[model samples]
Every structure is written in structure tokens, then in C-alpha cells.
Target: WHWPTAWCHMFLAPLFAATGLLLRLLLRLLLDLHALFFLPHREAEGFKEQGNAFYIKKDYEEAFNYYTKAIDMCPKNASYYGNRAATLMMLYRYREALEDAQQSVRLDNSFMKGHLREGKCHLSLGNAMAARRCFQKVLELEPDNGQAQQELKNAEAILEYERMAEIGFEKRDFRMVSFPFLRCVMRPLTAASFRQISAPLSGFLLSSPRSDILRMDSTNADALYVRGLCLYYEDCIDKAVQFFVQALRMAPDHDKARLACRNAKALKAKKEEGNKAFKEGSYEAAYELYSEALTIDPNNIKTNAKLYCNRATVGSKLKKLDQAIEDCSKAIKLDETYIKAYLRRAQCYMDTEQYEEAVRDYEKVYQTEKTKEHKHLLKNAQLELKKSKRKDYYKVLGVDKNATEEEIKKAYRKRALLHHPDRHSSATPEVQKEEEKKFKEVGEAFSVLSDPKKKSRYDSGQDLEDDGMNMGDFDANNIFKAFFGGPGGFSFEASGPGNFFFQFG
Candidate 1:
């Protein structure tokens, strides 16, 4: 029994030894395989070395990718961030580059290359004040840095010129709005005139400091944005938008310029829409669009006045005469020399039979407008006012301008019966009041026409102007409707005594 136990023990010990060696070899092979699949070939420094190689070759895009990997691996490494920022600048990704440059400086404040890259990034972003500080810091760390000194000088020059341009824009641009009278006077001028007007700035354009900054450093976002504002004010909209977009591309943080760009685009689109609707004779739609334009750009006085005048024209077409007159008056008040407003209001007054008021408005137009059509309109208004002042007693009585005394009497009696207030007593109170006023008008006309001398004076256009009518107090539209035959036609001549229901109040 002891010998057999010794044999089993010896075989078991050998078997266990062989199994342990095989297991050890298997474990070692698995560890090597795992490392091959999952472990990196190098650390952040190695990745940055590759990035540097690409950067030296000027393959910025490839360099940026490698540097991004280095940053992901060792976020605390200032040199990694600094190198990546340099690559991003080469790629024209200034905003992204600026962030990296700032972080690189923050991680290791004494890293001179980080500070140098940070200064360049700030300069590119148009932060001249910040760039100056960074370059000053670089000089503190390394006193005789020629590159930093040159950049500092450039930043100072840019800052100074930007200050001067802003001052000029503020002082000179305001004069454009203050003189509304000059807007119409300048409208006939071509783009060449605008260029000539901006010729004062033309020197600025030829040696544009802002433009110079952009040319030297395409990522000067603030300088680019300021130039966009100047161009926008000059009415160079497309060029303005281009500059604004480039500014935003370089610096996403430029909120003020972004908002201005959006509003300018919206205003331009809405004006075009308004013009299209007006041309299509969709006056109602056009009016709403013009109203939107005014609301969007109320500060542009010349544009707002033109919008008001156009809306007034639509109001006239829509039969909103009073509102049209009100709008036209506002437009004329804004630009007193606006001949179109005067013409529009004059025509409205003529339609309402306020010939004296029409004459005044027409006279204003004639003073500004030398067109033959306006001159003829002025003549008509003057003639109508002369005829209106005499109170056309014969026309008021619905008798022929040459009717005999007996016929005038008969016509008066007929009109009196037709317009008696009692006949309208069952109608609305407003109608009844109008009927009473009209009855008085008829009675006054009858009294004058029956008197031979007064009648002759009224006919000869020399009657008393005060006692008969103040045209505004009457509903001339209703009177015209009634005097015309069947709501369709009427002669300029006073018709024979008809069943006239002259509206008055």
C-alpha cells in the first residue's frame, strides 16, 4: 500500500508541474495580444511630434488632426494646445485657434511660445487691446522679441485708426438724416453721386485702415465688422453683407454685427416684396408689406416717408380718402417738398369738392413740380375754386346754369319736397339730421336764386362767398351719387331739376 501511494503522488506532482508551465505560457501570449489590440503606440508627446512634422510641411489640415489627438490625450499639456492653435491659424480657423491659444497660456503662463501664439490669435480676432497685453507679456518673459514688438506696433496702429473712423462715421453720418429735404433732391443722382458723397471716405477707402488690417490678417473680425457697418450706411448692401459674413466666420462672438446683418437682410427682402405687390396692383397686400417695412426700419426717415406716401396712395385706391389724406399729410410734413404727397392730397380734395383746399394743395405741387400734367392740374383746381366760392346756386337748386327764374322756382319747390326733414324722420337719427341740414341748404339756394341781383352775381362768379356752404360739412359723395343719373353717369354741366337727395350734415 505504501509503494502504490508513492507512485500516485509522484505522477500527480509531475502532471501538476506540466499543467502550470502550459498555463503560464498561455497567459503570457494573451497579455501580448491584448496590448497589440488596445494599447497606444506612443504618448501625447509623440502625437505632438507628428503634428509638428506636418506643421513644418505646411500641411495645416493634417497637422490640425494630429494636434487634436494630442490635446485629447493630454489636455493639461500647454505645448500641445499651443502647437494645435498655430496649425488652426494656418487653416484660417481663427475662432477655434483663439480658444486653444488662450487655454495654452492659461495652462502654463510662463510658456513663451504659448504667449506668443496667444498674442497672434488675439491680433487676428481684432482684439487689439488684448493682443497688446499678450505681446507685452511676451516681451516681459523675453525682453527683446522682435516679432512681438512688430505685432504690438501693428495693434496700436489698428486701434488708433479704428477710433478715428468711428468718430468720422458718427459725426458725418448723422447729417444725412437731419436733412430730409435733400433726400429727394439727391434721388436723381446715380451710384456715382453716392460714391462722390462718400468721397470724403474715399480717401479712407484708398488707405482704409480697417481694410489694411484685414489684408494683413484676414481674421481681424472686429475690423472686418466695422468696415461692414460703414459699407451698409453707404447703401452698398451686398458688399456689406459679404464683409459681415467674413467677420462672423472669423469670430462667432461678434453679436452686434450679427444682429445688424440679419436686420438689414430682412429689411431689403421686405421692401422688394412691397414693390412687387404694388406693381401687381395688390394694393391691400402692398400696404401691409410697406407697413412692415416702416415698422422694421422706422429710423430711416426718407424711407419711412416714402413708405407713408405709398401707403396713402393705396388708401386712396381703397376709398379710404380721409385716412389717405391723413397719411399724405404726414408724409408732406416729414418732407415738405414731397410733390407726390401734395398731388395725391390735392386730387382727394378735388374728389370731395373741397376745391379751395384742393387749390392750396395743387399750388404746393406746382411750386415743386414743373411737369405739364401738374401745371394743367393747377389750372383746373384754380378754376374749380373760383367756381366753388360762388356757391353755384343754380347747380345747388338743380336748375340749368342758364335757367329762367320761373324754372328755378319750380325746381326749388320740387327739391324742398324731396328733402323735407319730416320725410326722413322715420330713418336713422343721423340721416334725419343730414336731411334737415340739406333742407336748409336748399332753402338758402332758393332764396338767392329767386332774387335777381344775387342770382346774376352767383352766375357771373362774383356772389357772396360766406353764407351758402362750407363744402367740408356736406357729404359730397352722396350728393354726386344722387345728382348723377342711376349711379352710373353725370355731365359736368348742372342737370335740369332732378330728384336730388343731396346728403348734408
Candidate 2:
């Protein structure tokens, strides 16, 4: 053991060190764990890279396929799930994306990207409450998450709007409600509420995203006409008119727009005619023209009210007392504070001998009016009320209070002949009825004055109660008997062949 060869052998290294390293390498190859651990992961990363490229290019279909394959290869990978959910969200497949994002979160509870994607999916699906919860959770996990905070604020705003809408609908307070939901869905860029509070916001939504009016192309006329129709429904009458005019300028043969233009033109002409009539003091003509205009445009409030006011004035002037009252009532129904209608109707009632009704209308005008003209009219009405009184029916019949019996008979005969129903065949039914009534009153006056007993009773201011005298009671035979000696004065005899004589002596 103490020899030189033994000392040299003791100082020499092991010959199998290289063999051990080689053996370890062979063992790694046999187990196939190195390729299994790294190569598949590397392939997944390459696929993810390609997917990202395609997604950035907006080739969502290809990106979706590539991401799906990557996710299949790496089933437990949170990043792959997040990418796929994003692509699905872009494709508007929100429900499926929500499931994928939720699975990603389950796989890795600390994944902020997964929470954001899920929240976006919920938002897209109109689940704002759920989206808000998810976004809040993301902010809780990562306090510096600006995107999550912004999204949470948006969700809260949406929730607040929905709550307001619910309260408004419950209380029937539509003016307090905003149409945020419709705006979100339709996404109109330049919207007008169009003075119609209940109108849906989709009415203002343009098919194109741009605000500039489209130029007239070969198809522009058709598009313009369609847009005009939409604008008309949206209550943008001026814009609709412009669109229709443009359409007509481009294609004069467009039947739809031509009809619309013609209707609008006719309506405008009728309105102008009404205004002209009103200015010229032709109230009846103005009412007719306004009514015609309303026939063309039923929703025209100005025309409706103008027609009501003008007709009310016309009815008053024409002495159509009830009609004037109804017209003013309708005018006030259309616009509750129509001072002119109230004033005009008050005057009409005064003319019609309805003092109390006139006073009420005047009071309504006084309550609604702030003008000096109305104040003056109300003062005039009060003065008129003091002077108003019931008219005498006997004076209206144009007969004296103590006319002789022959004079009364002659006057009654003349009046009955003048106002007979047969003389008024072409008159209105109401006029004919009135004439017949006057004729009957004249006959009654003659009958009462002709009878001495009735004349005595009527002269003493006693009410001559009707005893239902028949025509037979006042017949010529009875009058002859009374006038010619009361049942002892008449004789009839056959004097000769075909001849007879009657005598009263």
C-alpha cells in the first residue's frame, strides 16, 4: 500500500463521471418529462402569440379558433381562457364568454384579467348589477385598478338610472325619467327629445353613424325618402321636410315623397289661408280653413286651437248661442287658459239672455288673463249683468195688451198666415218648428180674445186654465148658432125639385 503506483492511483479521479452525466441525460430522455414540461407549453405560447396577432387584426374567427386550440392544449391555463372570453365578447357571444371567464376565475381565484372579462360579458348581456359586483370584486382585489373603478362607476350610474325609471313608472312621473336604456341600446349620436316626453329614443337613431346628411347618389333618393319617413315619425317636421325636398329634387318621380311633399304643401297653404282669414276679420272663413288644415295634419296643435277659437267667434256672431258655448268649451279643452275663447263666450251668453252663464265665463277669463283687454271686457260684462233682464213674450209677439177682439183676430190671422209651416218648406227643421210654435200661439191668442168669458178672465190677470176644448166645440156650426139667435134662428126646406133653401131669421 505504500508503493508509488498506489500513491498515484489514490490521487486519480473516477473514470465514470462523464458516464454518470450521460446516464442522467439518457434517463431524462426515457422519461420524456422535459419535452412534456416545456415543448407543449412552448407550443401553447406560440399559438397564443398567433391568436393575439389575429385578434389585433380584428380577425376574430381565426383568433377564436387559434385560442380554442391553445386552450384545449392547456386546459388549466387561465390566460388562454381570458383570451378566448375576450374574443367571444368581441363576437357578441356574451353568455358563452361569461361561462369561460367564470371558469378561468375558478381555476385561478387571483386572476384580475378573468374578473374584468367576466364583468364585460355581464355588461354586454345587460346584467349591470352582476357586472357591478364583479367589477367591485376586482377593485377590492387590486385597489389601483383604474379600469375596474371606471366600469364600476358606469354600472352604478346605470343602476341609478334604472332605479329612477322604476320610481317614475310607479308614480307615473314620466318627466323625471331618462331614456338611458334606449340610448344604450340604440346608440343615437345626435338625439332630440322632440318635445314628446313619452316617445322612444330609437326614433332618433340613424342607421348610419355619421351626423352629416347623406349626399344624393343613385340610391340616395330612396334612402332620403325613408329617412324622411323616420324623421316624420320622430316629430322632426322641419328636418323631414328638408329630406323630402332633397328627395324630390333628386328624383321628381318618387311617388312616396311626392305625396308627402304635396300633403305638406297643401297643409301649409291651408294654414296660411286660415291666418289670412283671421287677420282680415273673416272668422267663419278662418275656422273653415283651419279645420281643413287639421284634416291634413291631425296632430297640429296650432291649427287645432286656431280652429276652435275662430269657430267660437263665428258662432257668437251668428247667434248660435249653444254652439258658441260648446266651441269655447272645446277651445279651453284644447288649451285650458284660452282667454279669448272665454271672453268671446261670455259675450255670447250675454247676448243669449244667460246672465249667470255669462258671468261664470267672464270670471274664468278674469282668472286666466293678465292683459288689460281682458280686464276691460270683464268690467263691461259686469255692467251688462246689471242691465240684463228677462224679455216680455207678449211684446215679442207684436200685439197690444188691450187690443179689441176684432183687432186681435185680424192680427192673429195675419201672423198665422205669414208663419205657417207650409210656407217654410225649405227652412231648417228648427226654424220650421219655431214657426209652427208661433202660429199656434197666435191661434191661442185669437181664441182667448174671441171668447168673452176667457177675455174677462185674462183681463183680470187670472190664469185661464186649459179645459181641452175640441175643434168641434168651436166649429162654424156652433159659431152660427151663437151669433144668429142661439138655436131658434135656422130652418132648412126643400122648396122645389133639386133645390133647397136655408134661412136664419
Candidate 3:
């Protein structure tokens, strides 16, 4: 064992070196295990906190970098992916944010913030339907989430606006289609005070879900303009004008604010002129002025609705019955509760002898107003409609309603003789048929009018005793025979009218 001391020294030195290398490898593996099991978790948590701090400071790029680092350290952590997604959204990388959000939800389907971020991305990218589903999913996870409720309302309002606009386009109704986006964009912020007006304007305020940009930076021109829109739609025209002017001052190139301001001013001026003209009884001038006002801003739904109604009134005065009806209908479409429009349309329908349409409009007016005048109009329309349905027996017989019995018999006899079918038997079939029809009408008129009971009933607007009565009930031949003495007693010359003398058959 102790042979050759130099060889023993060489072997011992090599064995010690190998043992040292093995010990070093074991220590390195232990360090790697520590970094894997403990250090990464701590580092990832620290990175996530840093990312949140940058996010709170609104430093989106730095936030994005930190969140990405956290994700790199903890790739399967749903919260890291969600945080990264939110930072990506703040950076305006919606597509990338959407991917991260989706991944976060896939990693942990119950992550409400991940779903919220995904919904936000979808909304920003104009996928309202998809955004709605995401918000709905969030609500399913946390039913009382106020943010998700508001966002869900926003998506639903957008979809409803689109549906209404499509219906208006299909019906060729401009009132229903105009201002839909404006209304839809205003929904979530003013749902209680202004129930009828809503909007889906997700980015109009240019703010993230966590904080309002306008609150942070009041000089944002676009935000100011959107506020102006809200005021303008709420009928606060002066305040809206002020905001619009402020926006224009902040951003000199703000074309929409300038146009809105101009339109608001012009609308007020033209509407006032229209009112002046109407008060002065200058209906033609009023109609022109109101029409001009309507063309100024189609997005001003309330003002345009009023303008349409005013124009309808002027149209009524100018005897433009059809145009008046159309204008009133437009006003009603713009504002379904517009009682004045219904009244105007009813009057136009009355003038046009459209009693059924008049009745419908008057009924709506009466239902909404419940006023004595509206009720009277509704009743009058119903009466006129009832009378219109019945044949004017006196008119058909060429006699006045007050014609005496003798006068009625005389008129009927003359009309019957003139339109007798046999007298025109040699004429064309069409002419013969027409003569026969008139002959039957004359006889029926006599049958109804010559009888005192029937005449009284007819004059009183009561239905005849026989509801199924027709020309057959009148028996023109029998009436002719009875009037001329007997069935075979009288005949007429068929050749010409002047040679018609009764002869015994």
C-alpha cells in the first residue's frame, strides 16, 4: 500500500480534486432548488407589487415591463397574467391585453378581474356583443359588482341602439335612426335622472375603469366635448355651448365641438324665428323656418322632435295634409309621448278623409292627454268613421236628406227609369252591367228612403234591421212592376230614350 511515494501523491491529489468537484455540484443543485421553490415566488410577488405601484402612478410602460417580468417568473399565476393584461390595456395594446386576459381566465376561470379586463378590451375594440358576454360572466362570479353592472348596461344599450337604428332604416324613418349613438353613449352615467336617454360611450371620457381622466386632467378637449353632448341632449343648450366653446379653446382643431356649437346656436335662432312666424300667422314662413331648424342638427333628438311637431302644425295651416302627417309621424317616432304630434296628425287625417287613421291618432291623444278636447276629437272621428262606412242613400238617389216621401218616390222613379237594364240591353255588356247596378241602387234607395221607419233609422245612424240585406232585398223588377201598375202591364222602347213610352205587355 505504501509503494512508490511519488505515484501515491499523484493518485491522492486526483481523488481529492474529484471529491471537491462532486461537493461543488451538490451545493449548486441545492442553490438552484432554493431559487426554484422559494426565490421565484418571492421575486414574482415583488415584481407584481412594483407593477401595481407603476399602474397606480399611471406609468403604463413601466407597469407593463414589471408585469411582464412577473409573468416570466410565474407563468401559470392567473393574477400575474391579469395584471399584465390590465397594463397592456393602459398602454393601448388592446389585442395583446385581450390575449393576456384570455390566458388569465383560462388559468383560473373564476378570476373576475381577468374577465373584466377581457370585457374592457372587447369594448375598446368595438366587439360589444363579446364584451357583454364577458361582463355577464363577471356578474355570474360576483353579482353585486357595480363596474360589471354598468358595463353590462353599456353593452346592452349599444345593442339596443343598433337594433332601433336598423328598424328606423328599414322603415325609412330618419327620426328613429338619428341620435341613436348619442343616446346609447349616455346610458350608464345618466340612467336614473335621464331615463330615456342612454349611450355606450366607453372612451368618451378617455378614462380607465379605475379613475376618470377628466377628473385628473380637466383640460381634456374630447372629454369636455362629450360633457357638452350630455348637456346638449339634456336640453341645457347654454351650458352645452359653454363647454363646447371651452373645448374649442383647448383644442383649436376640434371640428366636432365647433360644429356642435354652431348647430346649437343656429337651432335656437331658427326655432325662435319659427315661433315668431307661427305667432304672426305667417304659416308658410313658419314652415320654412322650422324645416331649416330640423336640418341643422339631426343628432339633437329632443329639439328635432319639437321642430318636427312645429313644422307639422305649420304644414297643417298651409293645407299640406300629407306632409303634415309625415312630419307628425316623424315627431312621434322621435318621441313616442308627443301628444301634440298625435293631435296634429289626427287633424291632418281628418282633412284627408282618412277617418280610420284619424281615429287611431285621436285615440292615442285621448289616452295620453285625457283632456276634454282630445276626447271630443276621438268621438268625432269615431262618428265620422261610422258614417263613412255606410252608403249615402240620399246621395245615391240624387235627393236631399230632408226630401219628402213624394220627392223620394219621384226621384227614385226617374232614376230607375233612366237606368233600367232593358232600356240599355243592346249596349255593350259593361254598360249594361253598370245600368243594372244603378237600377238596383235606385230601387234599394227608394226601398230604404220611401219607408218612414227605415228612413228614420238611416238618418239616425242606426244599422238597418237586416244586417245581411243586399240589392236582392230591394227587388228592382218587383218595385218597377209595382210602381207601373203590374208585372206585364208596362214595357219601354229599347231603341232610344226619347221614344220611351210605357205599353201594355
Best by TM-score: 3
Q: Could you arrange the candidates by lDDT from highest to lowest? A: 3, 1, 2
Q: What ordering of candidates by TM-score runs from best to worst?
A: 3, 1, 2
- Stretches of candidate 3 off by over 4 Å are 1-231, 234-261, 279-282, 394-418, 428-433, 446-456, 466-472, 475-505
The lDDT values for all models are 0.70, 0.67, 0.79
Best by lDDT: 3
Clashing pairs in 2: none
- Clashing residue pairs in candidate 1 are none
Q: Which segments of model 2 are wrong by more than 4 Å?
A: 1-26, 29-31, 179-505
Worst ten-residue run, lDDT, model 1? 177-186
Clashes of 2: 0
Instruction: Give the root-mean-square deviation of each candidate in angstroms.
Output: 26.3, 33.5, 25.9
Misplaced by over 4 Å in model 1 are 1-254, 354-357, 393-395, 398-413, 416-505
lDDT of 3 by residue, 324-404 (tens): 899998889767888888888988998898999999999887877888988888988998799789788888899987888
